[model samples]
Target: MDVGDLLGGNAWSYVGGTLLVLWALVWLYRDGLQVDAVADKYVLVTGCDSGFGNLLCKNLDVRGFHVLAACLTEKGADDLRMAAGPRLKTVLLDVSSRDSVQKALEWTTKEVGEAGLWGVVNNAGRSLPMGPSEWMKVEDFHSTLDVNMNGVIAVTMSFLPLIKKARGRIVNVASVLGRVAANGGGYCISKFAVEAFSDCLRRDIHYFGINVSIIEPGFFKTAVTSLEPLEKELQRLWEQLSPEVQASYGDKYLDKYIKVQRLIMNAICDTDISKVTGCMEHALTAAHPRARYSPGWDAKLLWIPLSYMPSCVVDMGLKLVLPRPSKSV
Candidate 1:
């Protein structure tokens, strides 16, 4: 039907319009449901031995994605390989080390041809809540950057050529902390860098049909925020502190902080990670994927607003939530 005829002058115009829209949807859905866009395509996912990375590798493999799972240790590699089955290959990659990164690139290129690689998911990262910024050691902060920020870049660069060739996706596992920072630590800064990098990559690669998306999760029962060592260190610090400092902000303050941490951990543990997995699948599979995905309820309700607020507002809000320091010795 002609455009003018369909506009209002034709008898069957309504029926033609309906049929055209249906046909377009059918065409789009034809290729969209296969979330494993890299099915039979080489995909390298970092930190595949545990947590989100492990789950993603398994999920992708089940959906027919050929996964080159990168683990840090032999035991981790062995476990991943055992669970991943035939389609999943294991490689020991320490993303923080240049030598390890180069080795992984060489091995990946040789094992799966440069043209065969489809996607790279930078899923390995650590979170260290090292008390206040002033209290934390420089090494604590620097090492955090070494792994979270530097490591992601190293892996991304290693596989960029292959990803470009395939016109594939890059899924970066940044945190809600990346977007909002009430909690001051090295981890937050590293995640912020990751988010920035991912955004830059998405813009730069838009013309090339390559997608770069960041997953900003609030808390997902990951090992990054384990409280065991935290508790121990806090106790040790309490013992070492001078009486004046102890009297000024007594055990009550520390107790409150620990309580908050516990509450957060509990909330994270209760979250259903399937929500995140679903988001990851969408990023890899959707014809028109979003630039960023927030995978948890807390991420949406809490961090999203915090992310947009001014620094002073965020600081005030954080102070309100944090338990007041105790004055009793």
Candidate 2:
């Protein structure tokens, strides 16, 4: 045989063999191929007005899951109900509101029943990335903490009995920022607390055959980042600063901050959100779910590595991206 012909045929054979192996693997895991198994399982998801909550609710409903989508506003509830069929229910639930949570629980138990409850996804979270800590107010930090951390806790506690009885899973939508610190002001801190809380919950509930999973998504084309309010907030933040701080940082710093923020927003918009949703589905229905799911390229490539890196190294790396206070003359 000619040398050229032998090399070409062998290379083609390798490619063909690799494709066949991949096809076989896909066939084996066909059931696990992001197909929702939420059928007849009543799941209560908080923050369903938009973002992951809404998306998950719609996706699950389409896949035959009985989803109880809890929204904060009437409009959100209406949107969810319209988008999803009768199998998907919409209720007004504010994780920060004790009364709302109590009412929602009663409604779910009375209507959806305890036997059908399979999972609870605490996907409702707010991120206020105020660039610099100094610029962030105490109230801003506390408010974010209340909604993100305290909110998750309240929902979990309220629904713990149902989850335990059903041996269901708890999916907490934490951020890669939680696992690895970021330049974000209060968001990272809140996520860190969430991570700790979820870990403890997992341990406590394991004996009861309940699983707790945390999703650390890098970014996605969600309303949280791409909305006009975020850009308006950044502009407002810059405007509200003291003259001394404003003068010191000037337009350059503000511009850089906005640019960086936009870059992140665009990246999130560019990536497929299914990567995050796929993890959410796995966390909910997988027989052997992972304790933590890091979704997206940024989460896998950057956040995970930095999370394991030495503290000093991580700090040095962060300093380059983050803004620092100006030096005195």
The top-ranked prediction according to lDDT is 2
Cα error, candidate 2, residue 113 (Å): 2.3
Clashing residue pairs found in predicted model 1: 250-326
Q: Candidate 2 residues 154-240, lDDT tens each?
A: 999888898887788899989988977765567888899989999999998799889899999987778766746776777777777
lDDT score for residue 256 of model 1: 80
TM-score of each: 0.83, 0.84
Reference-based lDDT, residue 111, model 2: 61
Where in model 1 is the C-alpha error above 4 Å?
A: 1-37, 233-248, 326-329
Query: For candidate 1, what is the TM-score?
Result: 0.83
Candidate 1 lDDT over 1-329, as tens digits, reads: 87876666565777888899999998677646654435557778898767888888889899887888999889989988888679889999998999999999989888777565777889887776456554455776887799899999999977888888888889998988888775655888999999999989899888988989899987776666678976775565566567787677765777787788888687655346777777877788777777899988888888887778888998898887777666522
- State each model's CA lDDT, in order: 0.80, 0.81
As for candidate 2, its clashing pairs are 38-65
Error of 1 at 209 (Å): 1.8
Model 1: C-alpha RMSD to truth?
A: 6.2
